[model samples]
Target: MHLHPQKSLYDLAQQHHLEGLTLPSLLALTKEQEGYSIDKAKRFLAFQGRINNEMLNHQVIIQNPYTAWFEQGDQNPAQIKAFIIQFSVFSNQFLIAQLHKMIHADTLESMHASKEILANEIGVRFQSGQQHENLNNQSSTEGSIDGSRFSFSAAHFEWLYIIAKKLGLSFAEIGQPKHGTHATLFFCNELIRLYGGDNYQISQAASYAVENWAAAGFWKQLIQGLQKYNDQTGLDLPLGFFIWHDKLEAQHAAHTQEELEELYFTQNLDEDAFIQNGNEMLAGVAAFWDGLEVQRQELATTH
Candidate 1:
């Protein structure tokens, strides 16, 4: 894949005659938003750091039932089954579905698109790989460094399936599917679809805030819990979803921050827009974690 020099988003919008496109922006900032002030940006980034940590602190995944279960080395099959249901649905499938959608938007019609238009889209997958090292042997056009390989989302599903099978729970019995929190995450999904072709807009809110902050923290606790669950239960189930993310998502998140910071320095990012959407993204995810807590509490009361 040929890498092109970066172009201003303003210029790309002008060139594509897409300035009049009516997609609702997450940032809701004035179009005349000026270059980012490093001092202000640093402060806001720090604020995001605090908010991210706080959201994790509030998650039920980090609370008593899970903590008590892990500490006591509980192996109640019913308890393990209930936890897996919430874990698979809200944490794994929901998050991966959103990512798959965003990745599709980024990679669609990519062959004819300019590097400037497709850079971030490809960068996301490249840093993570196509989930297939085999792609490295293919031609550039067929399997470019940042091009599609195996479906990352499919891998997540496989993880869910393996866990369900190990616990002797059919896919149907994980737990009652809850929509209250997922509905909020679905809103974030719509945002990815809304900004489908605009990698800059989609990534600003979706990748940075959602993937880097929300998913990162959620997964950290989740992976640990699953490991402990595995030890106590002796299920030895495949947990590639957790393992895969635990290893690579941090690298992806860091790369995203560096890329965004570079964009800020180049006056390509709108400060107000990023901050507004970043906050929204974080809140949406925080609610997602809250939903997991609700599911846990429901299990507690019923069990």
Candidate 2:
């Protein structure tokens, strides 16, 4: 599973291009000491807390200019398409790894949560108008996975493989991800294992951020780009990933919000701890996006 990381961002970008990515105008990358570092975890959390508080006061996720650019269809089409494919590659690489590790549970509440998570990971099917009905049938308190059918890892990879082909990428190319992609995967693993047999702590932290504070605008822009790509190319590409996530994540946010609220009142969840976990998770996600941005710029320079 450990493939060699690409040495040159530009070279990696080209590889991605061969896999069906579009190069866009390069943006200046402000050089920082590269590589993921968790040493600044505390400081990053404090900074994120300030930002979160500001958002709460203002009632907005604070629009990223990139989202606006994409939504307006002003950004380079090829670059946007590359991003969509790269993100899918990234998610496919590590998402289930984290989910599998999360299956180990100690407490009843955590066990229920884990089952619910695993069921989702397996992609339980539901008929149209039956999504909520099925979810409601799932235990609200015990968090059971009794009726949920588990999906094979191969089946999931097949989904990714098909999507990549539709987007002009081969399975082999999509599997070879940049360091940033691995960084995101590594962080998820670390978050789950960081608490030393107390997986629930870090899990709550990471989950709360992803399910609550992660930017909605970005996903909205991504969906718009994917739809446009399908339209322009006249291709029946697998856009179910982004399209489903656009809706599912919103519901996820709501569910996690309720979970947090319950924990805050009943479990005496520390604000600082909660914020720290959320921000640390966000930091990893930010690194993933930063990698994509740098690759975009590198690709542009070559073109």
Candidate 3:
């Protein structure tokens, strides 16, 4: 969905009478941004919880005394997207997978190892002349969805949709902003094609990412500020689940968080209560992923 004019950072901060950097200005925005309440009533109450903490926690900095998200009240869709990409690149979960530090993030230690995966992935290099096919293959070897491949427990799929929809976005709309996740994936794929990085290869690399980005076109470039992060985090994320997660949504009843944990996380729970609990329809979500296996294999092999 397009962002509302009012949601622009500059616009929002301006609404609160904040247009410059100062303690009063910062204090005012904390009341507005973190003070934002989608479900809560009485904006004043919202301010009380997160406002002071943002400053105390150093989550909101005053360096250079700039006010972009706070004063400008606007973020070009591209800037908002760039923020996600740049920040996510540093995520431990994403990097661990790239470095092959560990298969996936299940434990806190491995998860912590991933904290700098992006920084490392970007700066760390494969030893020259030491690059082995096996190492690159290790990256490719980590299990991936066959376009038809579907292995997530149905409970997982249900969780994504419930979180996404409840947050007022379709799962389809989550990460496709400026350099959306897919765009990043395409860029990596393109760079691999230009493995030598010669002049000729440079053009091809740009060409490849540009083509994919072009195909996605308008909406990809015009992403608005985030609507809800529920789609990005706070839900079970199986790698590349975005591609097939939506397929399960049409098949399940609407769900809430409690039901999802009960079904997937709990040792035992009644299936019927899922409706009240806001879990995905387990049968359909499971079937959808499992059903995609043949197709997934075909896509993986051909692509």
Candidate 4:
């Protein structure tokens, strides 16, 4: 649905003549934690990526060189309806599920903790943007090919530890989340925004940091989280993991390409569109997450 200038989502629904699909259309989905596991998250990410590709393809399909809506008055109603569904809430729904997989609980907990300590190290409040000159010099810089990553400033590790403590995820067996330089940097920048810190804004550099540093952590968490989720959900996650690992190994041995193309489309993405869509998807899904409050609370309580 087209986002109206007045900022209501319903206007487009009416324009499309679909009564059930509105700005506030409710999804027939649940957010129960009993159903949570790493495997489910991974599988869903894979699924949403497919849907995301479909929507992106549709954007290409909907190209209109003509200047006016009136010029396209003869456009199919079904086509317009499909556009509404794709661009509106459905996209958000798909994204939310996909994010739960991408943003692992372990990473969140770790990053949160890391941010807190980093704040102390930098002598700024948590989520503040002041770069600690001393700490910056101390932290060894790491990077990926995109060159978006910066050193995980000393303050960040401190922040992560604190956040992990806040979430009660510090048990030795549970372990702190694995993170790299870029993820550490961007997460802190985002957390500043997320926690309502001063005017610390996200930048294109921050976006690049996220894309560059987060992949390994995400895949690692996806594997471990799915394993635990399998045990909780009574799923064959163990068996799945076994086969998945085996296949990856076998494929590595068999394939002539040193790197697997399927692992990532790395260095080949339209970075602007990729970052914009990824972040927008997160923002859109976040709007609907309040409805999942009950289930989320229950999950929190049980844990």
Candidate 5:
């Protein structure tokens, strides 16, 4: 459903305040008011399962020739550079989508859920585990003024920046709109327009599709190619960005499931619209890979 255009972000934030209410308390209140239906929730889960299966088999990124070439350990400097620059366009704008999700969430529970994801995106970690300690030690360049550990090491985009720098990309080349190809720019715009847009359900659907897409092993494929490239070129590329995202996206599969369950339980969903928007978002993603493939072919012909 379309949210009121005039509602400021602050207004939406105010509306979702937990006010000392625990998750269970908020969920109970929502159920009491919304008249929770177990049967409906089950139906939604079934539909969601179909969508997840479809995403797994989606030939867009999964079967794209460019993806296959990269996975096969092909290393073309020009093509790889193009991929890095274009992907940075998407990476930098992702925060806007997360912000939109949090602000446009219909319920406090959903808002909190979105907030947690955003927190992770922005480098907020609740647990100071061994892995984090390793990250802190490894990211010496990101040390603060006093040489203390900073949270930027955990930030996803910061990791991307590190990857870009290792690949010989300048800051201006990574995220600048002018550096993005037509399909890459379209994909980035689509993320904000759908995933970060004011339509709460559509945004959720788009995000669900994206989470599933990420969990479908593309990151692993890219990492394999990148590792091979590093070995062949002796670049010693720090692949923490791809590696961390691969792990996180695996976890996001469960997170997306919970998000959908919460959405099913707490709000009335337009299932048809949700499905349609999700496919549309994936189409944009397909275009992105298609664009890269076109460029890869062009580079091949020149050689």
Candidate 6:
């Protein structure tokens, strides 16, 4: 029952000579030895509540003037193109963060869970939610998982690229890191450092924070703007990418709730450290949006 700063559940089990135990066994052992308390559960729930509230009210997405402008419609094509380019840069680098999460996972179950997410990112569909069986499959080489083929066409970035192309953007324009604004590049790098790094607690908290951010309805906001732009300009922007993310992020809300419970209840968390990392990750997210806002303003003045 001894707590070690920043150590994972697996690390704690190994420290207590309880190695090789499954997640359920480890949780039972920890709860039995520590004497489960309702007060502790309440505190965990309160912590989660705070994180959710923070994301819901985060100024970066909720209060950002750019989001309002975009939602209102009739956006300049240049501004829209700029948004796509920077977002695509961020999206393309996200797969590396997922791989890092899988590699740094503290348990087999966590690793497999991370792999499932990576598989989905790269366009691997699961039948009956049976993704664990193909966690070992090489997805990078068009591998098949449970009869679902890994296809470049299905990748999330490819979806973004398709949208970008409809806006007359070329591959070099959307895919290159050199085109990202300072804030955009900084945000992508922060994802690697916090979400993809070796610190399991920090990574978990960052990932959880991001899922909450996505669930806060930014995708819908963007879609509103895009739909308006299409109506005003008579240009058909394929919105399937944003629409798909809106649906997926809604589902991620539940997934993140389960992740938080499993992480907080089973692991010996450095609560303050976890909160700090989540805040830091959100700051990066804010910066990315703020950069886009800057561009939007500049375009507004010119137009």
Question: Pick by TM-score: which candidate is best?
Answer: 6
**Candidate 6 residues 154-219, lDDT tens each?**
677888888898889898888677988999889988998999989888898899778878888788
- Model 1, which residues run further than 4 Å from truth? 1-79, 90-154, 172-199, 214-217, 301-303
**lDDT tens readout by residue for model 3, 147-201:** 3122222223333334344435444554332323443443343332331133322
What is the alpha-carbon lDDT of model 3 when measured against the actual structure?
A: 0.30
Clash pairs of candidate 2?
A: 22-78
Per-residue error for 267 in candidate 2, Å, reads 1.7
Please give the range of 10 consecutive residues that has the lowest summed lDDT in model 6. 134-143
Comparing 1 with 5 on TM-score, the higher-scoring candidate is: 5
lDDT order of candidates, top first:
6, 5, 2, 1, 4, 3
lDDT of 5 by residue, 21-94 (tens): 22333444444646344345446556666665655457874576777789877767877777787777777667
> Number of clashes in every candidate structure?
0, 1, 19, 21, 0, 0
What TM-score does prediction 5 earn?
A: 0.76
The most accurate candidate by lDDT is 6
Candidate 2 stretches greater than 4 Å from native: 1-51, 54-61, 72-81, 122-145, 148-158, 176-199, 301-303
Could you tell which candidate, 1 or 4, scores higher by lDDT? 1
Q: Cα deviation of 268 in candidate 4 (Å)?
A: 31
Better of 4 and 5 by lDDT: 5
Error of 1 at 161 (Å): 0.8
* C-alpha TM-score for every candidate: 0.55, 0.63, 0.17, 0.19, 0.76, 0.79
lDDT of 4 by residue, 59-135 (tens): 21233121122122222323222222222222222233223323432346434533432333332332223424232
* TM-score leaderboard ranking: 6, 5, 2, 1, 4, 3
Per-residue lDDT of 16-122 in model 2, one digit per residue for the tens?
33211111110111122232122222333354456367332222235444454446543354565466556655656454544554455567766665555545544
- Error (Å) of candidate 6 at residue 220 is 0.5
